[model samples]
Target: EALDGGPLARLHDGDLVRVDAVAGTLDVLTPGVLERPNVRPDLVANGYGTGRELFAIFRDHVGAAEAGATPFF
Candidate 1:
C-alpha cells in the first residue's frame, strides 16, 4: 500500500540501498547510509574536495562545551 510507487513494499526496514533513479525526480544515489557514513581520512587527505568540505563542516559544528568535550570526528 505504498503510495509513491516505490520499491518500499519489497524492502525491509534496515536494508542497505543505492537508488539508481526515481521517476520524474532527480537521480542520485543515497549519499551516506548506515553501512557507509564517512569518507576515510586517507581518502580525504588525497585531495577530495567534497570530503575535505565535509570534514571542515563537521569540525566546525560538532559538540558543545559543557558536555565534557567529546570529539565527534
Candidate 2:
C-alpha cells in the first residue's frame, strides 16, 4: 500500500507497466507517468499512533513488492 498510496498514487487503470526481471528493472510505460505529482503520506500518522512506530525500521527501508519487499540483503 505504500507505493500505491505514495509515489504511484497517480497510477490509474489502463496505465502500462513494464517489468524486466532479467535486468532487474520495473517501469511504468504510460506516457507522462513520471510527470504526475505523488501523493504525500502523513508522516506523523504513519510513524506514530497505534504502536506503528514499532516497525519504523521496516517502514523506512523496505523496498517494492516486485523486489521481494525485503529490507535486508
Candidate 3:
C-alpha cells in the first residue's frame, strides 16, 4: 500500500523502506530521523478555478489516492 503523510513523516531523505508486494506490507528501517517534506495541504482545500465545484462530485466519490481515485462507487 502507499505510505502517506504519517508513515512518510517518519522517514528521512536517505532512509530505505522495504515493501513486500507479495505480503502487502512495508517496513521503515529508520524512522523519525529526518524531517518530513514540505507540502501544500492548504492548496488542496482551496480548490482549483471555476471547475472546483464541478469536480467536487468526483473528488467526493473518488477512492484512495493509490487506488486510482476512481469514481467507481
What C-alpha lDDT do the candidate models reach, one value each? 0.42, 0.76, 0.63
RMSD of 2: 5.9
lDDT of 2 by residue, 2-73 (tens): 555554676778999888999988788899877787775556756788988899998778887778889894
The candidates, ranked best first by TM-score, are 2, 3, 1
In terms of lDDT, model 3 sits at: 0.63
| Top of the candidates by lDDT | 2
lDDT of 3 at 13: 64
Provide the clashing-pair count of each candidate structure.
Answer: 0, 0, 0
Best-first order by lDDT: 2, 3, 1
Badly placed stretches (over 4 Å) of model 2 are 1-8, 11-37
* Per-prediction TM-score to the true structure, in the order listed: 0.19, 0.46, 0.39
Tens digit per residue, CA lDDT, model 1, 15-35:
556544555343224433323
Candidate 1: how large is its RMSD?
13.8
